[model samples]
Target: MPYKANVVVRYKKSVLEPQGQAILLSLREQGDESFLDVRVGKYIEILLEAENLQAAEEKVRKLAEDLLHNPVMENCSITVSQDD
Candidate 1:
């Protein structure tokens, strides 16, 4: 069966994100003073053939940790689901 992997990659809490900061500043300037902070991230979806959901999750997690994101500065979340 084929599975779909949804991956989200974001900067670690301790890491600085200039682009996110810039966007936050812009929002604040636009009268959105309630905004505190912003962290820009990437979303990626991959489809792969797997034997089961567990296997799909494992494969996606490895891909997210190895190829989809940099573990040093970024953190990743992977979700696997059956494809229609």
Candidate 2:
């Protein structure tokens, strides 16, 4: 079966995000205080063949942890769906 994976990699709650803070400052300066806080991260989607939905999810998770994100400072999650 073929599956689609949606991955999100973001800094841990306890980690500091200088880029996000800079963006927040800019937004506030532009009079956009609508956001309480902002954090920047990566979003990736990939399609791959897998034995099953569980296997697809596992592969996606591994990619996220092994390549897409830094496990010590970041957290990652994957959502899987059938491509067919």
Q: Which candidate is the best by lDDT?
A: 1
User: Could you tell me the TM-score of candidate 1?
Assistant: 0.86
Candidate 1 per-residue C-alpha lDDT over 1-84 given as tens digits, one digit per residue, 9 for 90 to 100: 999989999999999999999999999889998888899999998999999999999988888877889999998888899999
Candidate 2, 1-84: lDDT as tens digits = 989988888999999998899999999999998987889988998999999998988888888877898989988878899996
TM-score of each: 0.86, 0.85
Q: Tell me the spans in candidate 1 whose CA falls farther than 4 Å from its real position.
A: none
Among all candidates shown, the one with the greatest TM-score: 1
Candidate 2: RMSD to truth: 1.5
After TM-score superposition, the amount by which residue 21's alpha carbon in candidate 2 deviates from its true location, in angstroms, is 1.0
Worst 10 residues of 1 by lDDT: 59-68
